[model samples]
Target chain A: MSHATRRNILKTGIFFACCGVPHTRAALAWSMSADPLPVKQVADGVFAFAGAPAMMTRQNEGEICNVGFIIGDDSVAVIDSGGSVVEGKALIGAIRAKTDRPVRYLINTHMHPDHLFGNAAFKSSGATVVGHHNLPRALESRGTYYLQSYREAMGDDLMADIRIVPPTKLITDEEDLDIGNRKLTLRAWKAAHTDNDLSVFDHKTGVLFTGDLCFIDHLPTIDGSLLGWIAQLDILNGIKAKFAVPGHGAVPSPWPQALEAERRYFDVLASDIRRAIADGVPMTNAVKSAAQRERANWKLFDEYNQRNAIAAFAELEWE
Target chain B: MFATIQLRNPLVAVVLFAFFGSAISSSAWAQNADSPESTTWSSLKGDVFGQKFIEPANGIVSIEAPKRAEDAAIVPIDLHFKTDAASGRIKTVTLIVDENPSPVAAVFRFGVDAGVTHLATRLRVNAYSYVRAIAETEDGKLRMTETFVKASGGCSAPAMKNSDEALANLGKMKLRVFSSKSSGMEPMTRATEMQLMIRHPNNSGLQMDQVTRYYIPAHFIQGLIVSQGNRLIMSMEGGISISEDPNFRFEFDAKPGEDVKVEASDTEGKKFQDEWPLASSSL
Candidate 1:
């Protein structure tokens, strides 16, 4: 067998032998039912679950975004929680199967519901939730609405224990977190995908967790400033990282190259909106036809492209 | 608190019916005749109009809105008014989104001889509801037209995208005058189109501050008046249902070389005013 498995088995045996107590039946049953989510070890000691590109529905249990955890010498740091508490529990189970380290931090990349809905699952672990400084305000504005609105799509069962858990630790600009020997650099970005966009970089493994900042396969949504997102493309391309865990795409993708498709889509969307604004086309008409050429290239293009166009039209009209 | 009460209160329900009647008749109302769709409007009609007879629009006024809202926060509404001596000139038009916390989005009054023909603006639709335009003509007749708009669900709420950015440029205004392009217009019937955009969050006050546990008080442009060289063009009494960065576009007969002046005030008692020299019609 593998060395880590053998070591874990030995550690379990020692705990039972020394303490004279085994896991209770209920605890065992709970662990069995909450099977760990299938994850791939992209880098050494770093595991990620690449979510399917689909809407958050009851069938999928809201597992529609990338979520993962990193194991360090002393403790573990979860990059994002999932779209629902059930997914969050499965992630916790995955971390347990890998190591018996304490979870020190639960880092959220932004305030989007799909990225941070599983926050309540980390509450029992007492992991200090960390997010961008503006996250609290964003949540305060939309958290209740999110909880009420997602009920119909996600069902009552999956949302039962979900809570809008704001981060206790807020990163204003840049902060260094040491999860044992590993040092993670967290940076707060200006309004891009959303006002509270934050990114996490692991120094040891060179994995960057770009919450919703970078989208692939799925069309890039523009809930924030279109110009701001376009303006930051060069800087985001220059971010030093070997691999990136996009908010909604293949996890641990090769950095810089991972940002290519979204960059082009943003450029195309911006130029179309700019041209429409210059031509005196009303926002309603301009949004319907913006970026139609890129429709075939991305998932959920029809569902989101028009919405992005609406936001882009509003932003570009000021120019 | 206001939103919850609005749903159950008969007064608001009556106010919503005028708009909802045009929207629900096609989908939800057909399946169940006894649904709230019927009662909500029947009960609400009296409260809004109050003993005044309302009639369906017969080419007097018409409205255009997306069948399904692409973005709930910024649904566009288009309105057109026909000028005829029999129907008389429309003096006032009330825009309402039935399901919003406040059903009356805005009440727009046109100038006596302004000859305003077309108006367009954006709104924040809180739910699937009927968007209606009720026009009061000078001949003492009320003409109404409405359309249903399905709310764009999932992650898209009727909230500000960037609150900080919105606040940073609050009260800033921009006015753009579209040059007349259609050559078929008669000299006396030619109307110049101008779009006025204001930068404001137009906060709905539904959002609660977690730390303080109190609702963020509503802050929106409550009043606006646009005039050309001391001649009134249009005035509006707005509400929170209006989208952030309130925008209005209208086509009206213009007197060449007149300066267009706009004055507005918000709920917070802040007044903002600006004037632009109207471009000569020859351009």
Candidate 2:
């Protein structure tokens, strides 16, 4: 066995001993992860962390996508749900511990599992699940099948327990919600990540939540349009925000720097796709080459290396 | 010092357990080895995806698929059998990714003599799961071999474009045939290697429509069929997990001058039709 195995067994032995009660332990210790997702205090009332127990999004740095929490005067709005119900409840619990005020708003950045699967957990507290209008359709059509699949893979204990309902509030182009002193401007960015990618900006804090549109340390996963996503990122870059909470990864200190990483990654992907088209390469070959080239040249390249490459190629070459 | 072996912090144990669990189940079914795990995974549990698998006593035909796929979402699956074209030994190829949410991906039945060895096609993989190919041979043995694939998070990815765009081009398809090396008959023999790119939203409908205040209605490709110059070669009916603007690669018997026509339609009024002209140079 490798050294990693030795250390893991030792660690489990310790954890198992501590909780040595006669009762049965649910699932893996994944429920009680020692280290919570690393976070950045982007603003006074907002905190950001990459989505986790390490969900390998085909985008972003070696990080678990992005999950954010923005506290307002009357209540709190969670930006993007976690990869699983377990993670979502954990986030909810953390928020509850910090303040007794019920989480009144649950805003999903997009519909990807990493960002939206946990929405079901927040619904019980009567926090309205909010997203673009197409969100519910996306869920209903492909939702049940995946739901059952997860029930099988993750042992159904977590999924079977929660009630996953569609979003209560649907925003079109832009919607304004009043959190008392704080005005949260929710803008519907069209056809970017999915048909329903939404961006949340707080005028008071100058904090913008650019959902999946912005990936700081990782490459972007393109399930939408190649050109459209890049354009959306450019538009986001133009927006004025003091601290930008991207869909995943660290929130860069200066908003522009964080935006730059996203813009740069998209640029690399587009140019690679353009070049592949120009070279008359097949989509699969082009996808593989682009991924391999980036893996060799880019930093933190291994994280999203394969998924980014194929998803981008498939989206662009489809036409 | 206390005597003990430190297995350290590693995901190896978890992965090993998963692999062991799946491998045993799949192998036991193929060999009828009396292993308990196989009995559970290959229960032929439902009508949609699972089909009863009974090995041939005469050993006339066989099927092969990956032992383990790299991704569960998009698994590369193929079916090969033995016989002559005159017997009409092959009728239809039924594909079942048993562990997928819906299980049944496609069912292809042939009309004219597709021969004993007509390779089949490819289908969407919803997750890391099991794939079973049930070929109705000329005689009648439901031979099946299954392999476990490790893939996840396919259904959650958004549609490839705006709902309008994906909907606008629904029912469109592109057929392409290419060869890695310059070879004859071998390329033609690999008709099962054809690629069909269809245009459809395959909307999981979980996506938010940025423009409308309410959720858009769910729409996706429901039925797909492929024919070689008026011969019914394949038929498929599936839900949205088929992937947005889905592309399906498959195989069927074709001569150098054969004109292959394809037609596909979804539940929400989207339809696609295309006639592919087979050329010697194209392969």
Candidate 3:
């Protein structure tokens, strides 16, 4: 039978399993309802709600992270809720507007606040939350600090219902979930962007969700190893994806090509640090002068480059 | 007080930059030249060394610290002396975080037991400023070296430890003496390395209590004195820049039967003193 026919049969089977009847249109309609945010249909079944490339602020209402959902024949899977309750609720609405399918899984791309704070909105939906093995520890260690800082930055009103909701299902290396006819692959990465970084790949559409791994226009922050990030990029370059959804910037960007800018930045950072160490330059001087050649190339280089240089210097000096 | 002196002498800026310009970035050097709050070497020399003439520490003393601090609140600084007891004994060494509210970070006065004169510790730098180390020889001659560091928010950063837990073990200390050989080798004729760790919150008054949501009061080690038997080895005047548990690693000559004594006092006037036999093998 054709793929569409098989999906139809599976949907019919699920409907019968839920309602004990062959044709229950009202029951299906009751399962899903809400106004979801406008999303771009990147692939056959993948929808992306791209966020603006800006820092989280009260005016932005913590909408500085990209989120989306994937639809399978029998169920749907949501990827990364937004930064706050308002964004999460809006995402839920967007999901409802698009499909009446029950969201079987809520996958958090990483432990960052902008990506995972909207987890509470999906709690009542009973979607099994999933993340990397280290996500729970990362959240536990930094959750309170992040909450206090975000509250100060976004104001109490915007942060009212936001609480750290850790992932219940941990992916240590790689795992595949069959939403229906489609299979979504999740892979946990080494200490790169953070200790708990994970990416999702849709087999049918070849759309890879690279959470904070690939930054297009937005300058990347270095909370993890600079060298480790560069190494991961090499592996990411080999992945065959029709389109890639980045953690920041416009989603569904062309794969492999979108990895250039970020890779170049890391390369420059590592070389500059190595040279500085060889020259017996102290961290103070290196922080100001290292990677200065890349200043004009990336946005927000001034704000984060120095901090990155400091971290790199400490690591490279010992080596 | 020296801020007024700098206004009168513009040449002091030129001279000060000439000394530190090669070690620090031009922008930082210019910032020091332009900043009215920036203390010139001569000004600090007069204030710290008084009438004593301070010599350049090109080969005599070297300081190892990050030019840009990874963590501004805890910047590790190592002071190494090239000259030994045969050349000229290191009598005293003073550490200064130039831009901190209390610029006088610490003062180490060595006695006869002073051996190798290699000292290392950590401190907080409140702003982008120079970290200067001045060492005095037994003959009353002073030598100085300074490195410009780029960091800020050190004085106000929160303590990493939980307040209640920190308070529970407050004033506790640990001492470790490095042995020349792992096993049966006899004690060396020269000085040996030793590290002292004190358990104190060293609350910077900037950290908020996570539970109470209130600023913890500033209570840190104000004075630390290390002695061998009746002879004084070194003393330190500490500030919030010292990490949660203040640590000091230095070198001293080990006299077989002499006892190593430590006396520390915090800002709240609580004093802690302990003694250990120098011959103890285990740390």
Candidate 4:
């Protein structure tokens, strides 16, 4: 069965519980009412272009994320790991079936738990994990909390059984690794999606693992300073890649378009936060107002919608 | 025969056990305030650490913590002691975070724990009360002062994030060593300040999971040990208020070049250790 069909089957099975979230459940049931993990071959060498099956359509809903592969000579370098280790291992098993080529190098675009938490499975295979230097510290700082949350949220099986080992390697500004004659350039961007977000560029396939820095359909999560994130997007817009795999949502053709969409989200967030500040609303009310206006555009609006507005005002008005 | 029969009944046995458990924990702090065992500032005294805190009529230790804090989770406290004495005889200084539901937060012992007799650190104050500091004197008399801080409902401040995941990085330790600012003035004592950023939830277990309504069990850093190339750099005894992800900074007897390693463990049986090869970085 296809990945989206599987995830949708899994999500549909779990939707009854997810419906508990307020405001966006109906829309999610409408958009993702059917199969979501549709594995379309977007690029020449890539397969299984999966989209995120939103529990609720806040902003980043329709924007499904993809977990595809590039067949290398001796081994394979899977672009990004799915959200949880359960999903990660499933993809790894599928990849293992495709080619006996070692699932050699697992490249994480950033330090977000959704991307790096599954390192242990690959670690057992002795796959060398790589990311920017700050990724380890970021993961170290928040890793404990994420485990506790998962244990409590999903269940003990997912967290208790899995050991969270961080990326073994760290790169400062930029570095290149030869994966089967293909030179993949790992470039570090300034604090945008996070203090450390690294994009992996393939000279062979030209796939850029943009991480959370580039989201196609899903509303981008702004953990880094929004102003700083906008500037980083400008830098990302300059890079050349055939396809960009976002932290969440659809896999799209390179440069400027996905970057532009992300830049627009921040622009909207900034203007709204600015208006709230200009109206002399206190932080809480200002955030409330920002959320009401933003709910229409972004997915996951129920989850991080308020958080972004609150964080934006804190960075701009207070800081 | 009737009393023996009462003990054997399972329902009766459960009630009796419940009564004792509730009486032991509940009565310790939940009694009438007018009672003698009331957990107030006046309740604590004596050299709890068995150290000389202050000499009689020699100095003043004032607290520079917020009367009310921004984040009850992390409150900044500055302990500034008068250093007018020709010889600083502060054998030891202890912080008593009284009035918190958990009472004693944490304590710092100074041996190489030297300074102008002044120091600053942050802690989590779970409630409003007078935080007492007992400075033991070389002359064996302990002088005490108190600071009244208002912080309410902290032990329950939403376990920071999901717990099991946070525990994964529990023992991951970060050591940052730096140079002393008072290099020119203090020719006698060489002190370098080092900060230990430990990864721990330090959860007091008072928090509730919003969705499940279940109480989160307590998990905190019970012990933290720091050493500089085999030379002991004092171990810290921590409690609930060590704050989540516990950060500690203090002056220690170290030169510009000394390798410092920090080893720590949490209540959950997880250990994290890291070493910082000291550099000539400006403190």
Best-fitting candidate, measured by DockQ? Answer: 1
List model 3 lDDT by residue over B1-283, tens digit each: 1112221354644544543443333313343433434444546667777888778886677888866554554577888887755348777788887755566788877776567568888776654577888888776778888777655211112223223335677898777676554455566565667778787878666544434867657899999999888877788878776766777877767667788899999989999988888874532
DockQ score, prediction 3: 0.04
Question: Which consecutive 10 residues in model 4 chain B have the weakest lDDT in total?
Answer: B152-161
Assess each prediction's global lDDT (C-alpha) against the native. Answer: 0.82, 0.58, 0.70, 0.57
Q: List TM-score (chain A only) for every prediction.
A: 0.90, 0.78, 0.87, 0.80
* Candidate 4, residue A136: how far the Cα is off, in Å: 1.1
Model 1, span A1-319: residue lDDT tens: 1322532455345544543444444444445544466667888989888887877876677788898888989999998898888778767767776777889999999888888898898887879999999898888877876776566567667777789999989999999999889999999999999998999889998999888898989888888788898888888889889989988898778888998999899989989999998888888889889999999999988778988999998998998
Clashes of 1: 2
Off by over 4 Å in 1: A1-32, B1-39, B184-188, B281-283
TM-scores vs. true structure, each candidate: 0.88, 0.69, 0.57, 0.50
lDDT of 4 by residue, B1-283 (tens): 1111223344543443343333233222322211213244333443254433434433466666655443345555666565444434555566777645566666555544434344555576643345666665454556666666543211112224223334656666655544454556553356666556666768777654433767656889887777777766656677886666676656656644567777777777877777777754543
Docking class of 4: incorrect
- Candidate 3 local lDDT, A1-319, one digit each (tens): 1322532454335433543433234333533322234566788889887786665766665677789999999999999998877677667765665667898999998877889888888877889999988777566545654665354346557667798898889999999999999999999988777667899999999999999888877777665556678878889888898889998877789998989988888888889999976664544566678888988877656555775676566445534
Stretches of candidate 3 off by over 4 Å are A1-35, B1-283
Across B1-283, the per-residue lDDT of candidate 2 in tens digits comes to 0011111233533433353345334322222111114443445544533465556323334444433332233334545565554333666556666544455666666655444243433345543445666666665545555555444343332234455776676676777664534355575564534667776767544444535765655576777777777677666666644556666554456666677788878776757788988776565
Taking the tens digit of each residue's C-alpha lDDT, what string does model 4 give over A52-108?
634211122212345655666677776656555555664565454345567677877
Cα-lDDT of candidate 4? 0.57
**Model 4 lDDT, residue A281, Cα:** 47
Each predicted model: what fraction of the native A–B Cα contacts (within 8 Å) does it retain? 0.48, 0.27, 0.02, 0.00
